[model samples]
Target: MKKIICLVIAYGLVFTPLSILFSCTVEAKIVSASSVLSRQQAIDFVKKAQKNQWTLTEKDYFSLSKVKSTMNPYFTSAYINEFVNVGGKNTKSGWISNLRDTDDVTGYLPYDTPGKEMTVSYSKDKKKIYVTGYANSEGDIYKVTTTLVKTKVGWRIEAIKWL
Candidate 1:
């Protein structure tokens, strides 16, 4: 009787904490997956803006802000705004009225596409994610890496590097 009881207690001690640790790991993976999905949405939004199909609203603006702070602050706006075109006249008559507008330029390009094939890799700690893919329009491949931190508003991007 004593041997059986001691063995049962020993097994419980060994497996209980291991099960808890496994549960924690699974939860972390779910969080990481959610972050990846959000990042993908952000990329799609930029693509829509590139095609002049973007609907600028408070909600959309806030969603873009999520990935903006992670990018190089100096060029972040310009990089994303590459999708928008400001309409104006450049004539010999000292130019014309400047008007900001969103239109599909002759060589406009979409930022990201779903069927373009992408690879998302995340760190074991779930604090960093890297996305690499090719742009359908330019056929140019690019990689973006971002770090995330848990915040009251869920996961917030901390930094990003485009290469």
Candidate 2:
């Protein structure tokens, strides 16, 4: 029927553009994600990673423990041993500590109409820094929060939470 054809055409006109716009928005989020670290942050991160990597790779458990002591509480003392073992065995788990790979993905902001990626925020006392990263999606958004605290040794990740 002509009515059915017209209705189908109308729906096609409305939905086609809507779907196109939605897909473009999703692509934009991926493109806009912060995929690089600041120069200073990169330098600091690489320095720490290099020290830890060398110590761990050399099977220096004492040095590894000292380094991990500056980490967040979520990282129990047990993690240092696990890290040593993983690295010693030459497994992919060791890759997790590779500082060179720490780039823009380290920082992410939820995608939105405003398109702002909130990277780091300081606590009122300025002793704690919160880092948030997650997909900016309407459905099934998984967020990871990293909280770091300033310590005598330096700034250490105090906690990481998945929300």
Candidate 3:
């Protein structure tokens, strides 16, 4: 009886971890399937972000906070922290800081363009998306690259750069 009990306990310990791991993997797959991030979704997010009132002037008070709050649905925390400045005298040294100092408020990300030619690529694990597109602004077309990361809430922009 003692040997039998020891054998059963040993088997339980080994199998319990394996079962938990498998279940977690299955749950992740289910979540991913339900929230599958597609190329169209990424493109649409960029367009939406472009329309957000992110341009702020030096005189604008707490504008960055408002933008960050408004953009919370579409951007990751890290991205917001890196790009959104809180306010004057306590600026986060982010992209919004530069925008606040710039005279051209219209010169923002995802510049208003007349046409569309966005390309999207997924990471090997499909947890990240890379978007490249052209934006027409100031009577010229420029290339822009953006990265989107998959999160529990949905897909959010990680980074964007002009190229």
Best candidate, lDDT-wise?
3
Best by TM-score: 3
Per-residue alpha-carbon lDDT of candidate 2 for residues 1-163, written as tens digits (9 for 90 to 100):
1122111212246436433221111222232112333435533443353344344223322344344553322233443445434433333333233323332222221222133343666677766667665543345556756565555545544454547
TM-score of 2: 0.33
For model 2, state the Cα shift of residue 16 in Å. 89
Q: What's the best-to-worst order under lDDT? A: 3, 2, 1
Superposed Cα deviation of residue 20, candidate 3 (Å)? 37
For residues 52-85, what per-residue lDDT tens digits would candidate 1 score against the true structure?
Answer: 4222211222333433343322123454343222
Give the Cα error of residue 70 in candidate 2, in Å: 11
Which residues of candidate 2, in runs, are more than 4 Å off?
A: 1-118, 135-140
Across residues 2-115, which tens digit of lDDT does each residue of candidate 3 receive? 122111212246436433222111222233432656778778877787666354343345645665786687778887776653322244443344445543423246655457
Residue 37 lDDT, candidate 3, scale 0-100:
66
Please provide TM-scores, in order, for all candidate models, with all chains considered together: 0.31, 0.33, 0.60
lDDT of each: 0.37, 0.41, 0.62
Q: Give each prediction's root-mean-square deviation over alpha carbons.
A: 13.8, 19.6, 10.9
| Model 1: residues with Cα > 4 Å off, grouped in runs | 1-110, 136-139
